[model samples]
Target: MTARTRIAAVAVALSLGVGVSACSTTTADDGPLVVVTTNILGDVVERVVGDQARVVTLMPPGADPHSFEISPKEAALILDADVVVSNGLGLEEGLERHVDAARADGVPVVAAGELVEPLEYTAGDAAGTLDPHFWTDPQRMVDVVDGLEREFAVAIDGIDADELAQTSAAYRSELLELDAEMTSAFAAVPAERRALVTNHHVFGYLADRFDFRVIGAVIPSGTTLAAPSASDLDDLTTAIEEAGVATIFADSSQPDRLVQVLADEADIDVDVVALFTESLSAPGEGAETYLEMMRSNQRLISTGLSP
Candidate 1:
């Protein structure tokens, strides 16, 4: 199948809320296939690869990467893919077996987390473990793009080197511009109020990059699958009170009930704001791409924290 036909099929499947495998049926005449685990990585891979390959992103838009499961057909796509891209560092809990199977079958797998300098959770159950949400920092994402370009040139057969170089360079420039924008936007906020409390521990990289303090998280764990105890909530409330945080940011892909409960039950006054932290939103929902997601979060964080 041609690139146009494959893109049309994927668009139709997404419109109908179907699995990625529905549009990723391969043929002898088709280009190379790239099976990506998360939509965030998928967006970057698509931007890097352009139309030279068929990219099948397993995780749907606005879905939690920690617990989203895939169909058998999607698993088959991984095994049959020329290259498989994942966030790695244990982010995709539901697709580990499939990714391992593809690796065992001799397919090249490029992990974004491994490409960037990973950060560890500072105060949660995953404190000593590697954090997989490196996309939170656009500089780290540029590193991943550099790695992807190198990996794709080797892994994807018949890929045009000149086209890949051009696309990757263009996307890298955009990421650098995004990093500068975020830095500028965040610089306006007072340093004393640059504390962040989220629904989970998803912003360690962002905090490290932008000189913000991660006060605490509602869940107190790195993954959304973990729950926060009453003690966790109490401690976070105390920390919030001490820091005098005016806004608590929650993941747009996950429910903000825990955040809301903390805001309502706590004696301190705090506003619960949503940010596109982990997953991208659906079309026209403000965070359709990685760049859009970062810019939206930058604006929200600046406005939400400014006194």
Candidate 2:
């Protein structure tokens, strides 16, 4: 081979190598690329992974997981991730397609809902359906951490298993502290006043966890995509009156129009309060992380339900 020709070939090979390395940036990091579906789960995974992996969260802050769609770039992220963590069981209606596509692409998916013991709505339009909003209960969240830690140890290359287990234990301790705080704080609310009328059936786990009664949701369904009929609102209004609920909680991410309308329609005066029920709030707001979100919601719920 001529010296000039050999030099040209070497240059071309070097250029191609740089391009390949740049293209695999996500995978070229220190550890595996983990794509999380929701901000809440993202926070949890971030805490568990620490600096071990590159955790890319798909859902933005204050966006509803049920209706938020991903961009093409975010979808590509899922396709290229080493593993995907999602709150499956139909919570993420809009992101479901991307998750399915990622799964079909042979990416490992660790679903939180499937890992924990799922609860079902007893009444309302979504009766007998599995409830996907389980993070309201810290116990279930600990289960999520356990599941995620296991997945990370197995799927994420270069992940330190002992470190992951230690981090999981530490985060689980924090979750337990959150549970204790919630239980102590909620003790102020008498059992009779523990009735909850929220934006939707998003607190079945919370109610079941702390022995609060889920009076009913304004939308009468699990997801925010569903709207309530006049009859549904009327029934909820009656339930509120009978339950003597002082405050009706609405999601901070959603419009409070329905809760206000129900409050106005009820024969008995009721206060409509907003809570960070569905999505995490932006930084500086009370609920930026999963733990903060739970604490903030606990305070709001305690105040709303207290006599």
Candidate 3:
């Protein structure tokens, strides 16, 4: 072959090789990649998986899981992960399509939210809708940890089962401790003052866990994406006045305008407090991790409901 032809062929081969390498680098690496949809589940799965795999959380800190959508890059990560973990039952409203696409593409997905003994709205316009915000109750999150460990170990090629089990157990212990502390903290609130009003119906599990009454939600639905109707607001305002609720809690990740409307409509003395309900906050904000989120919420709820 001519020398010029040989040089051209070598350059072509080098270009093709670089393309292949870039594809491999973008797709994945040595460790298993577990893509989690929400920061709350991301933190819990991070605890269970430990260093066994690389956990990539799609939702950012302080972002709403119910409405947060992943970018194309993050969607690619989901498709490439060894296993995709999502909080199912409609919590991830914006990301569901991408998650479904990943599942169709053959990625094993563990919807940890399904592992919980699910709660449904008892009495609201959205009654009977499954409550997807199960992390409000730490015991339910313990169930999530159990499911994640099982699925991650099965899907990840070389994940250490022993390490996963130990980490899950340790995390469950911590959740139990949190449950106990929350129960005790809530017990301080008088029964009459245990009424809960919130920006949305995001805390059914918490109310069920701690024996508090879910008087009404400002949005009248399980999701913040749903706005309350005029009648809905009117009825809730009446209920708030009748229940003599002292506090209305709003999500820290959401704008408080709708909640402010409710407080104004009620025209009563109600403290509007913010809680890290649907998402964890940035580090040092007291709701960085799942455990930290629960503790901070517990204190807030206790103080809000105190007579």
- Whose lDDT is greatest here? 1
Score every model by TM-score. Answer: 0.90, 0.89, 0.89
Residue lDDT tens for model 3, 271-305: 88999998788778999888888898889888887
User: Which portions of model 3 miss their true places by more than 4 Å?
Assistant: 1-30
lDDT of each: 0.83, 0.80, 0.78
Lowest-sum lDDT 10-residue window in model 2: 15-24
Collision pairs in model 2: none
Candidate 1 vs candidate 2: the lDDT winner is: 1
lDDT of 1 by residue, 230-295 (tens): 566678878988999999998877766557667765567789999888778888999989999999
- Candidate 1 lands at a TM-score of 0.90
Pairs of colliding residues, candidate 3: none
Give each model's clash number.
0, 0, 0
Which of the two, 2 or 3, has more lDDT? 2
Clashes of 1: 0
What TM-score would you give candidate 2 relative to the actual structure?
0.89
